[model samples]
Target: MTKPIKILSFNIQSGMGMDNRRSLSRIAWVIKCSGADLVGLQETDKYMKRSCFSSQARKLARLLGMHYVFGGACKPAFFSRFGNTILSKYPIKGHKNTLLPGTGEQRALLDVLININNKKIRFCNTHLGLSTSSRQKQVNKIIELLGEIQLPTILTGDFNTTPNDPVIEQLRACLERKSVSTESKNNDLKTYPSDRPSEKLDYIFLSAHWKEICQTTLPGQASDHLPLLAAARFIS
Candidate 1:
């Protein structure tokens, strides 16, 4: 029997906490404490001035002793870039970044294939556009990509929308929402504005090959958005 894999998704806002302090170590601590086997992060900086030129993905990977891959959403500028990342305790076999169609702040979908306990799984991480139309287009692209892969997949990110939105409904049609546990009584899964969350912008979706064991939101001020942790096992 395979043990359940713990997955986490977080928008670290470049490691800037609600208290206005940028600390990659602090962000790493939150992820470490979650005991996540796979992690997807958004708004990570790489050699960017604002975040003190730190490669947030590399820093966190080193801090947690995990393998990582970063996909730059923004155009390169003097060796600096910003985008999404995937960190895995398992070996990452291959990875790529696909640019999503959007007007402002170029978004990207980071796709990676990981070998977990001899079973291969596709892990995708993304941060969608703020506009509804843009999100719709991005979602379509994501769906198209999912159709091309036959392996079990897990998608995670800050969707920038609530559960009631039509986009969420569209995604739920193809992938199962595994972040919300039926056994848990907590109805509110809001993750934005870490200080006082009112919106549920973060999410985790899985393919039919997996079964959800449990899920929960972690309490922390390491980033503006709270982290979501979910545990799931392969159905086979």
Candidate 2:
């Protein structure tokens, strides 16, 4: 029998905590405390000045003792790769980084294939653009990509929009997936502006094929956005 999988989605803001201090160790500690098997991280840095020129993803993965892959969206000086990442306890069977359609800045979707109890599952990590129009196109592209994959998938990230946004509606129309937390609950439990969160910018959307066992947001000042933890089982 396959065991339930614990997942975490966090926008580490380049490892900058609420105190405006950068610490990858603190970010790793938050993720570790969540007890997640697969973690999707956004706003990660690679040799960037913000995080002391360290590869935030690699360092966090090493700290947590997990395999990791990073997707670069923007290179400030064409030297550092900054974007999203996926850290997994299971070996990554395969992976891909896709650039999303947008004009504000280059955004990407990082997909990793991992096996759980011999069953293949796809974990997608991404951080969408902040504009309304760009986000609309980006969401369309994401849905289009999901349509091509047959494996069970878990899409997690900071969408920068509320749960009622039309973008969310479009994604639901295509993937038929549901956010781990209910819309009302998400509104009540804002995740942004860690000091006084009042926005629902983060999410973990699971395909209809997966069964959600539990979902909750973790309290923290490690980053501006609080991390979300969820437990689920594949419905195979």
Candidate 3:
């Protein structure tokens, strides 16, 4: 059997409605269409009590028919009203939320270890701070966390920076491969400002252990940014 893994990464924008519109259903459908084996989401929110709080990672996971891990990067719960989430078809063996310290706002790095056909892989998902300075700190924490894992790595989420930026450079410095475009029509799918996307804020990166066969950006949206998906194989 082929040991190929399909992964998707998205920034959902928390399904917020400035026009008083909620579109979680729409977001879910777009994700389903991607046919990804695993998904990394940003800006997922949920309401705990009276206060509108939560990053709806669990709900989205259920909708996708997958298991999930929510990483609390900023606060104990809902500091930024959002956090990172990972939905996977493989069984999760381990997970941790790595916190990034900075003055602007709290950020998160979610790490999950999963077993697929007995092959263990480590998946990292996160949404970085907007400011360049904040991202440097977050990225450093990720590099540190990655050093502890022996499984193949797959990192995904809204970087809030472009491929040419310094932060992305740092990410590429460690990761073996990065997805720029896709054949699944998900390539160059700019996701920011639902009205019109100009910035490429999402990604799915791979380690040297994985061989990428195809990549694409899906068309359509339930959030401000579109999703990125990639098809990869374990290098023989």
Candidate 4:
């Protein structure tokens, strides 16, 4: 029997905390405390000035001793290369980044393949658009990309919308029938505006090929959005 996969999804906001202090160490500590097997991160910097022109993904991966892949969505005014990141305990066999359709900021989806206990697993990470209409179109594009999944897959990231939003419904229509729960002890479970969260933005999704063990949104702190932790077992 294969062990369950421990997963975490966080939008680190380029490693800035609620106090306006930038510390990758703090971000790494949050992830380490989770004991996660795989992590999907958003708003990461690739040699950006704000982050001291350092590779934030590489730094965090090194801190956790995990393999990482940084997908650059776009460069803002030639100041930084920003996008999504995936950190995993297992070696990445292959990966790709798909640019989503949007009128606002350029967005991207990162899909990576890895083998765990002889099981092929696909980890899909993304940060969707901000506006409702843009998010709707981005969700449609993501659905098409997820269609190629031939193995057990976990889709996660900061989706920038409440669970009941129509965009989520559209995504549900494409995902395999499975219960994707986001229950936390804290009843509200909001994730934006770190100081006092007021929105359910981050998420973790599992395919029917997997069974959910548990899921929850961690308290906001290191970023504008709180981190979401989820665990599941792959079904043969």
Identify the leading candidate in terms of lDDT: 1
* Candidate 4: residue 216 Cα off by (Å): 1.2
- For residue 174, model 3's alpha carbon misses the true position, in angstroms, by 0.4
- What TM-score fits each model? 0.94, 0.94, 0.85, 0.93
lDDT of 2 by residue, 59-108 (tens): 99889999999999888986898899999999889999999998888899
Of the pair 2 and 4, which is ahead by TM-score? 2
Candidate lDDT scores, in order, read 0.88, 0.85, 0.74, 0.84
Screening candidate 1 with a backbone cut-off below 3 angstroms (N, C-alpha, C), the clashing residue pairs are: none
lDDT of 4 by residue, 1-236 (tens): 46878999999999988888999999999999998999999999998878889999999999999999999897875657999999999988999999999888999999999878667889999999889989988998998888855678888889988878887766655555654443423335677777787888887777767767787777758887788888887765
Q: Model 1 off-target regions past 4 Å?
A: 177-187
lDDT (10s digit) by residue, model 1, range 161-228:
98878887777667754433332233378898888998889988877777778778999899989999
Off by over 4 Å in 2: 177-187
Candidate 4 residues lying further than 4 Å off, grouped into runs, are 77-79, 178-188
